[model samples]
Target: MRELTIDWTALHSAFQMNMPEVRCFLSVEDGKVQKLPPGDPNLATVRADPQHFIPIDAIPSRIQYQWLDDFIKALEDSVVRERMEAAINGKGAFRRFKDILLTLPDERRRWFEYRDQKMRERIVEWVREQAIVPLNEAPWSADLPEGSPPYVSAHIDEDSLGNLA
Candidate 1:
């Protein structure tokens, strides 16, 4: 793939200049048009408040887990290092190893994404953590009323209490 170095701000401004009437409120400012606050809940609010809204294309949305970058780098470094060592031992060509190293970025990204569902898990966790809605607590096994079946009947054990009642 061709490497694209995007000037996000320039692209965004150009987009706005070309299509000034793009009817999206990016955010609200003092109850008017403004940028959306971090972890903003509504896309409609964002579209209406363009001043505060960051265009979708403006941001790099690399969803990665905290340690994924380091972990992937270490893994790739080890692979390249081993290949280099093998080349020094006359098992492979140094140029081949170098090329392999150069091509590792896509591989590393795939590995990171596959290994942990990296960005998705982190984003979901972040959204859940930042959500305004209250999460319902899991029903306690011992608290279930006598007549009620267990919340997870398949997992209930013979000795289990239904709920915390």
Candidate 2:
């Protein structure tokens, strides 16, 4: 079986899609993913070419913007929600949200860290479930310092080799 790999750093940006657009994009039929153009006959009228339909299994990744919903609703009730809705409709949801977050530097930093960690954890779990073995050295490992060689060898007792024979 082939495994899908996702970069965690991209999740926040991907979640910025508007609800209706995201919903329609994620909707599935006949095991195909759709990329419908605006006002296409299928989107406007009806379809026989259901091949473009998004798979139901892939829907969650498409429609996960609730983190933003919580953020804005808590910040300011109706007004903030309206602004965010407008920003989403205008296709600048993430940019507008970040703009609002910028006004509160500490909160913005905390939000970013929290989101990054969440995405990283999720990706790590998926990677483990898929049995992927990462070959490259992790950046923070004590065995490797900046500018050090990636490989190392240590002296061992020669007598140990005789056990193999």
Candidate 3:
């Protein structure tokens, strides 16, 4: 089989959004979240005030949990871990692991951040070893011909994740 290229950003986004029903809100001025001030306008007032509104994308979305570490940590039952570890070592889909993390909101966030950092480190190492330009910060031409291709991209799929495991 050919070595699969990874789109790390998309993978991150996929994992970060583990909470199917919850949406985290962040402060507009700072990237991190901020508490609504006391006596602050209510949701209705905020909706009426353009200054209080910001595009949803402007808010930092949740960071994705990493299957390697986050999934293991989020598991409540040891039997599940054993099965998961076995699956990870062998050929299997990651669906079960994600199912285990779905209900543990706090643990999910914690593990996500932890594993995400490690995932990033792994990406950086791969970049250095391969001498490839990073997708996040690549040196691209400011002035380019129309319809030019992007400078760099690294896409990963389920098959790639299985191989990485």
Candidate 4:
């Protein structure tokens, strides 16, 4: 496996970005993530050198919706869970779900923590898939059991959750 000094934060942001108008890539030479808008002159150069620049795909919306559903399922408060279930039923569900979380400071904090943990697990899986052995220690690796894989063991079923829209 090739070892590189990766900017983990930049990589995490690249994975989280889901905008249609932007594209992200990871520079194997420097292990930094690059975001380029359409028509950028440098994009052509990056695309040309496929060996040095690897395209980063954004996490699908279906997977994110599953995260929201799983979080709602784990909540102990039935009232809050019901509100969240309703909030995610139609258009603008992401915004509505966030709005409800904003009113509850503790739940809001918990949501952020949950989301970050899920994203970190995704990042670890992506890194391993790319055959990268990061030279810098990953912040999330500290909690892993000895000899265990660096990823969390949550299953994200895209088709099982159906459409949240």
Candidate 5:
């Protein structure tokens, strides 16, 4: 089975929440509240396709309004709370993410951004390094023959030879 792991360092700058913990935000619309999912689009967009980048005007009106309401209300109540709530409502996922990202302590946020950027740079460097290795390199240890210089040195005692025989 493949185990799933998360790089929560990105999340702290992105989510404004404790690392490696599940955080939920409630979405409010027309004064009614509902639970939002952890990976809701309003908060995080892991994979971006052209379709996902649809602007607020391009997105269905109902989704846009509900998201704005939830995000705005949460912002009014508490910045942290607002982020969490916006994350849930499936509205303003990117903008809400950007807003929460802006609310972070300047130094800490800058550090996080730097760290994330560095990680990407390092990953690219690593991939480039790996690409240069020859694919056909021998994968096994040397297999020495009997009486070869290496084999003779490896077995100084007659008993070792007898054992192998």
Candidate 6:
């Protein structure tokens, strides 16, 4: 496995973005994330050379929803938890959840931290699956507990629904 120092924030942004007309890639040689819009000349070249450019798959909405569900479950306040549970049932769950969080500053901060930790774990797993070791220190470098559940879901193409989280 090759080791590369990556820009963690850029990589995280790339992972979070999902658009039909745009594609993201990470340079295996340099670990820089590139967002290629439709019709870009480099798109074909990058697609042709998998060894040098690895496509960055967006984190699926189901995984993100699961994170929200998990966070809601951990909340101690029944009223807030009930509201969040109600918010996640249908199509606009992500936006609705954010709206609720916006009113609660402390809980919103906690949610961001929780989400970031989950995202970091997912990123680490992804790089390892690609046979690449991240050389830079991750925000959460501690070993995940044994038998941690994997967050795998089929891709949900719903760009019209807006951001997943």
Best by lDDT: 4
Considering summed lDDT, which 10 consecutive residues are worst modelled in model 3? 54-63
lDDT of 6 by residue, 54-132 (tens): 9998888899999899889878899999999999999999999999999999788778767766777688779889887
lDDT of 5 at 79: 55
Give the per-residue lDDT of model 4 (tens digit) for 1-165.
778888888988898887877889999999998999999999999989888998998888898999899989888899999999999998899999999998988778777767776787788788888888888866555544566554332433323222211
Write one digit per residue (lDDT tens) for candidate 1, span 1-165: 111222323322332332333332212122122333445567565655544443432213132222333333344357654654454334344344445546777543444344332232232232233231212221232343356433211222213312212
* Model 6 pairs in collision: none
| True lDDT of residue 51, candidate 6 | 92
Error of 1 at 126 (Å): 2.3
lDDT of 6 at 81: 96
Compared with the true structure, all predictions reach lDDT values of: 0.34, 0.40, 0.40, 0.79, 0.33, 0.78
Return the TM-score for candidate 6, rounded to 2 decimals: 0.78
Clashes of 4: 0
Worst 10 residues of 5 by lDDT: 26-35
Error of 1 at 118 (Å): 1.4
Superior candidate under lDDT, 1 versus 3: 3
Query: Which candidate's TM-score is highest?
Result: 4
Q: Return the clash pairs for model 2, or none.
A: 28-54, 33-52, 34-52
lDDT of 2 by residue, 85-119 (tens): 66554466677777877776754664554444344
Report lDDT (Cα) of residue 18, candidate 4.
Answer: 73
Per-candidate TM-scores read 0.26, 0.34, 0.31, 0.80, 0.22, 0.78
- Per-residue lDDT of model 3, residues 1-165, tens digit only: 112233444433433444443322322223222223335555445445433332122112222223464456446668756665564443333555556557656544644554544454444444354343433332221222345434332333322333332
